[model samples]
Target: MDMQSGTVEEALDKAAAVGVTAVVQVGCDLERSRWAAEVAGRHENVHATVALHPNEAPRIRREEGPGALDAALDEIAALAALPQVRGVGETGLDYFRTGADGIEAQTYSFRRHLRIAKEVGKALVIHDRDAHQDVLRVLREEGAPGTVVFHCFSGDAAMAEECAAAGYYMSFAGNVTFKSAQPLRDALAVAPLDLLLVETDAPFLTPAPYRGRPNAPYLIPVTLRAMAAVKGVDEDELATAVAANTARAFGCPPPR
Candidate 1:
């Protein structure tokens, strides 16, 4: 969850109650990025990612078109400077509906995030929504160095292979628990254990049994259950793998 949207106290309260250690608080704008860092400073178990979402990029300019990339790039770069912010993004393409921003702007924005992530040696928290090939293209073209995480990954097995081949990670969210998530399950089965991460993507994509509710970090267990079943592994093993993968990718230390 983005720390600014879901306050540190709220997430911490939830985590302590749920018995889960470490919460990666995400940041999407200058102010929120700063807030996330502040939250991370207070909780040893919390980490942060600084990003300016592609949609929000347009808000940087009154014009809702392409060309917001440059401003967004600069914003993300500034946010990257924060010490408590460990990664760069939640930035990527989203072409889900009509009358949205063009792919060119999205591509331009994605490349900028890749550049910053590479420069800082911070993981890239990519948000790919309906535009997989373009997202893959930008990463491949830029030769991203730091860990690349496909946040809330929705692609299937073959797509997972492409990501795995590129040394990227596939992070499954609550959506993986849906009965219609067979493709997601298949993708999870083949993704290398060490490259498999899990998240709730809170406030959206709540896993089954908890669907239609305000999502939260504690619901991460729902993802583990589905993944464990798909990989034919025990819940505990799956949980351990997810924890390790997340820690390894974000440079957040494993739970003690």
Candidate 2:
């Protein structure tokens, strides 16, 4: 919402007008992480997460070297300690965007993020794209944090079952409504309601019938409605469950 709307205030206002009570503004790098923390601090309805994106691993390694990557992780750790920063994330494996040579750096960065989240007692937000197996492997190898959320969950039923068994939250985005996303809906069907969450992935994955247009927290209802349909539950019931699940996952109460 901050990236798409005129200002953070405007985004929050718009979201509220459309029934959005709270939002977690995620950051992909140090600069954005700082911005997110600042936003969360000023807005009672907002929280933030800090981490370097998986695709950024190669660039950081190429331009600044491994030492710079370590330094950036250190900065991310510091930012993650902020009171409003409730998670360490947007980190995980992205084989689709990162090449083979960059996998090592990406894995290393992910491990550091896991450690930071654990140290700070925050949730772990994972961005797994075409690397589910590797992501799971790394989390297992490093020992996952108490709360783990798969942001814009892209796994199938089996993977959903695996994550559910491990008590990880699966946050569905607008992509789940795509006509080509039956498999995602299948995963949602099997996902435990207690561990299900909904997000906009705003300004990126707009729901069908509104795809290619800008997305914001206000548009979350569209995704939530679809999820409710998939789960065979009332929209309001699912919303309530997801709200509680989100608060539990991020360790924050809903906005009043």
lDDT of 2 by residue, 1-256 (tens): 6564688878777788977889999999888888889889998789999999998877899998888898999999999999999999899999997789999989989999999999999999999999999899999999999999999999999999999999999999999999999999999999999999899887889998899888888888899999999999999999899989989999999667
Model 1 is weakest, by summed lDDT over 10 consecutive residues, at: 97-106
Among the numbered candidates, top TM-score falls to 2
Which candidate wins on lDDT? 2
CA-only RMSD, every prediction = 2.3, 0.9
Per-model TM against the reference: 0.90, 0.98
Per-residue lDDT over 1-256 for candidate 1, one digit per residue giving the tens place of the 0 to 100 score = 6443656677767866765788787776667777777777777888888887766665554464345557657767877867667899788887774135455555666788888988888999988888888788777778876699988898989999989988899888898888888888889889988899888787888888888887888887776787888889898988888888888898878876
Stretches of candidate 1 off by over 4 Å are 2-7, 62-72, 97-101
Cα lDDT listed for each candidate: 0.78, 0.92
Which runs of model 2 end up more than 4 angstroms from their true locations? none
Error of 2 at 237 (Å): 0.2
